[model samples]
Target: MNSKVINEIKIKDGRVLTLVEGDITERNVDVIVNPANSYLQHGGGVASTIVRKEGNIIQEESDKIGFVQVGSSTITSSGILPCKSIIHTVGPRMGEGNENEKLSKAINSCLGLCLRKGFESISIPAISSGIFGFPNDKCAKILVNETISFLKNLEDSSAGIKLVEFCILGKDTLQAFQYEFEKSKPEF
Candidate 1:
């Protein structure tokens, strides 16, 4: 559960974007996004880890909500986790048509949901980059770029999202995100 910050950048609006190497389930942010399947099943991967650590109430809530569409997101109470809420976002699987666009939409959906709920901080993983077969570097680029775009477009300086973190567990995934973070630093 120990997590460490790998990189961080501050945007003009005073918001912070960070790359962390650790378990997203341990993040104490306002919300932590779960890369989910449409059926809301927490069977394997990060979804399973979150449910195992945070308790089954997360799964129970997801069951009540039923299916969520790809490129969309839904929220549930955080259960025993420190975060206030969990945003389950369905990302596209590789070989799916327009995978890049779908991934972008998924990221945007999570960010938009966070804005609506007034969440000041959120932790997200590299959606679809695991068993779903998304390439790590591409996933990293899309996730980082989409998040920066979302924050920059917000008209209100007090939009409540002061922090956006990419919390990755694997070393390769963390490296990919770190590369993106470095590439995007100057632009921010």
Candidate 2:
């Protein structure tokens, strides 16, 4: 329930990248990214948490959407949450081939959805790092780097995205993201 901004950096074109210690479901932003399975099941992990807090409308909408491919995403109403919408993205499992590329694609998909929807702010968790078994450090690094690249490459058409926050839960995950942000600070 308690959430706080741990660190942040300004990237090219005045985009803000932030690391937050909190529940992604509680983020007060335009949209929140859900690390979902291909089937859009809200059965466990962060998916279940979002359902429990936001209500079953999210699951109902996901059920209507049917299946989303790994490294892709879909959007749904946010139910009772503060945000307006949710971007449910499927991330690859750890043992799957090309895990790194898959995770990167997942992040890109979320960001792309944000751009298309004209959402200026979003909160994302460490995709595939929970029940899917991705390494915390690797997830942190990929998420940080990919987000930075996306923000930096934004042109006039994609400039609506002003804020991106990694709303991490566990201490270790938060620390990993913090480390990545700190390491990337000088480059931006």
Candidate 3:
């Protein structure tokens, strides 16, 4: 559990970046996550964004991996995305009692992989909170808290991850992170 709180979460000059939902194609980040099917195929939704930015290789290489279990993950090069990599993480679909656990894994995989790969910065989206149906506010609370806890546990080398952005796709999602972040702000 990373309890490290470097600073308050803000918009500009902040470590995290939140954008409008559904506009992934326009926002920029070091490495964007592709909410993919277990089969690693790129279809509609986030899949389409990856293809539009990283080229079809997003699907091709992913195909080689051939289906990840729900709540597990894999990685591939960004190819054409502004970022250096594309982490393929499978999120849970609409259901009760499954979203949080699955989201935890999805998030952990992305951060762990980036750290293992020696990346110092990364960007992510709320997992399982979109078309699959996890509520944005709930997912944001868990994701931010968990991610913060995870990062705080790392060494400086391990802690080199100074950036963990959330390119929000809508007002609700953006507000979720913002609201949660404020609650976690350090008391001066």
Candidate 4:
């Protein structure tokens, strides 16, 4: 079965922010962002799905990295997955102090890593919205804003990161992201 794209926004710089309803691990982008824990363990949630589908090599590379600070991100080989890399970002737990800020940092960290690696496209899920318990609406807002700002700040899109896709699973989350995307007015 093919995943349907629910929305597509064209950045003023000519890049795209796409919203898709599907399994994120299946996306064939240059990079896939994983909402991981500080320990870099893939025991459950989106992390587990990627590790299981991609192969143990992903986890092995993660083990080598050891730990990632909350709101920080690290990259690992994509293992058997189609993407070139997996960016493991550790977002904040809802009750944690400054949850909003932490989530923003986590996302920015992922984008920065993508720019550094010169990845032309990247796919991300709603980080911290699952077991980490961040509000879905809030997750959507921050993600959309951060991505738009990231693209806007680029000197001239010379870094090569062109597409940023939010791959949401389930109907409710997809709706939340789509709604937020609609409400947000991109700067152009």
What's the TM for model 1? Answer: 0.97
**Candidate 2: lDDT of 171?**
84
lDDT of 1 by residue, 1-188 (tens): 68999999887689889998889988989999999999999998999999999888999999999999899999999999989999999999999889999999999999999999999999998899998899999999999998988888888896679999999989898889999999898563
| Descending-TM-score candidate ranking | 1, 2, 4, 3
lDDT of 2 by residue, 17-100 (tens): 999999888889999999999999899999999999988899999999999999999999999999999999999999989999
Backbone collisions counted per model: 0, 0, 11, 0
Better of 1 and 3 by TM-score: 1
Residue 146 of model 3 has an lDDT of 73
Error of 2 at 133 (Å): 0.2
Over 4 Å off in model 3, which ranges? 1-28, 157-159
Pitting candidate 1 against candidate 4, the one with the higher TM-score is 1
Each model's TM-score?
0.97, 0.97, 0.82, 0.96
lDDT for each residue of candidate 3 in 61-159, tens digit (9 for 90 to 100): 887888798877788887866677888888888674577888888888878877787776666777777777888888888778777776656656323
Provide the lDDT at 185 for model 3: 53
